[model samples]
Target: MIKTSTQNELIQYVYDELAKNASEQLETAFMHDEELAESCSELLQIQNLLDNALKSPHKRAVQNILNYSKSLSLQS
Candidate 1:
């Protein structure tokens, strides 16, 4: 199994959130490791699919969450 940190790094890398240095590091790793390259490829495909499927939360859902937060704040 891949380390959690590596998986998180791959996710951030796909989203262009990784640091330049880390990105370069991962790039070098991917070049040397076929598995890492494949993992990155799969993560990128999933990221694209998610980007295409993006949508705003429903108004009611947002309102419900806000209301829940207010209730929790009152309890605190």
Candidate 2:
């Protein structure tokens, strides 16, 4: 069973947002806690899926943004 604090800390560690010392503590916890380790594995899979799904916008979207910005500049 993962406590809320441990879960939050692990999530931050996954995103590389945790402090160094805290991250080391979480790493040590992961080594000893099977549930925490499994939870980390699951979080990693979710992050991988999110990364694939949220890739940069398509070329058309980029072009549309650039065109809109250029139009705004011209208007000003």
Candidate 3:
């Protein structure tokens, strides 16, 4: 069973959002708490997938916007 402290620590650890000391503590807890480690791994995977998705061409249209703006500028 994972302790509440470990569960809470997972939130920051999974995303690498904790300070160095806290992150180290969380990693130690993760090594000892199977449930917490699994939860953190899942969250980390999901976050990584989401980050990759955001970087996909369909997810970001900045280039299209810039091209359109350039065309408009040329017309004006």
Whose TM-score is greatest here? Answer: 2
Instruction: For candidate 2, write residues 1-76 as lDDT tens digits.
Output: 7889989998898999999999998889888889999999999999999998977779999999999999999999
| Residue lDDT tens for model 1, 1-72 | 678999899999998999999999999999888888999999888888988998898899999999999999
lDDT of 2: 0.92
Candidate 1 segments exceeding 4 Å error = 54-76
The whole-model C-alpha lDDT of candidate 1 against the native structure comes to: 0.92
Please give the clash total of every predicted structure, in order.
0, 0, 0
Candidate 2 residue runs with Cα over 4 Å from true position: 67-76
lDDT of 3 at 3: 70
TM-score of each: 0.64, 0.74, 0.59
Candidate 1 residue 37 C-alpha distance from true site, Å: 0.8
Error of 2 at 68 (Å): 4.8
In angstroms, how far off is 38's CA in candidate 2?
0.6
Query: Candidates' lDDT values, in order?
Result: 0.92, 0.92, 0.78
Question: lDDT, candidate 3, residue 68?
Answer: 91
